[model samples]
Target: MAEKNLLEAFLKAEELEIQGKEFYLDASEKAHIPSVKDLFKQLAEAEEFHRIKIREIYQTFQAKKNIPAYVTKISQKQISPVFDPKEIEKVASVVTDLAALEEALRLEEKSIQYYQSLSDKSKDLKVKRFLLALIQEEWGHYLSIFDTMEFLRDPSSWYTFKEHWGLEGV
Candidate 1:
């Protein structure tokens, strides 16, 4: 049935959120740099929020019930890894900080694409709106990661604009 399909879609999205959270949490734990560690923790928190939201949506539609009043909660949980910790560790060990940030950026971009496709497929107004909101949220995640990536790639260039140095390359 179409409703079953929608539920499955949400469940898949929820799985991605969990995986993302787990990846970021592990990355934060492994990172030595203070700023990178903090960024990863923040990203993990956002992914957990998305996981809860997607689960709420799945429950609402699965039971043919209305959307519940939502509240944001920040809690840590142990989720099964979708990506191996060793793999992330390898990247951390071998790659630059920009590479790790790029990985997060890629994940956010992929999530946005998935949400956009889901929104386009949805015929119901509520389903469409829900997916649209998710897309917007994912965009915000992408932008944050991108900004961090830019800063990490070139600290002087990134801060020069705000510092009003009027230098092309700082």
Candidate 2:
């Protein structure tokens, strides 16, 4: 049934939220730099909020018709390793703080793409709205990271208007 399919997709989103929370919390434990550690913590908190939102959506769907909610795809393949610690290792080799920030922005941008696709796949309006909000939050987080890193690299460049905004800024 179409409803079943919708429930499955909604459940998939819930699972993703849980996975993200776990990853962020674990990374927070391992991060040495205070800023890095705080970033992880902030991400984890966001995930937690997403998880709650997903559950609320799940409950809403169930309440609509008393239909049981179930997800068929518990897939790692759908999950992008966008937040992998390996990103930092590789970025560190090529550059320092500014480059590091750029790399994270890239990752977050990629995640926004994934979330957008996933959001499009959902039939429920509430679910779609939640996904859109998540995407926006990711954009904000990525911008914050980029701006902070820019500030760190050049204190004089605080709020310095660039010749052009990158994709993230736009």
Q: Judged by lDDT, which candidate is best?
A: 1
What is the Cα-based lDDT of residue 15 in candidate 2? Answer: 75
Q: For candidate 1, lDDT tens digit of each residue in 1-170?
A: 28888899899899888988887888787765566677788889888888987888898887899765432322334221122223333333424556677887888888888888888888877777777877777777677667665555555665664456784665
* Deviation from native of the Cα of residue 87 in model 2, angstroms: 21
| Model 2 poorest 10 in a row by lDDT | 73-82
Q: Rate the local accuracy (lDDT) of all candidates.
A: 0.71, 0.59
Point to the candidate with the largest TM-score. 1
lDDT of 2 by residue, 1-170 (tens): 26677667668766766766676677667654455556757766776776676677677777775323343221212221123333433333333444444655665676678779877886655556666877877766677666556545543444335433345745
What lDDT, from 0 to 1, does candidate 2 have? 0.59
Stretches off by above 4 angstroms in model 2 are 65-111, 148-170
lDDT of 2 at 65: 52
lDDT of 2 at 75: 21
Report per-prediction Cα RMSD to one decimal: 7.7, 10.0
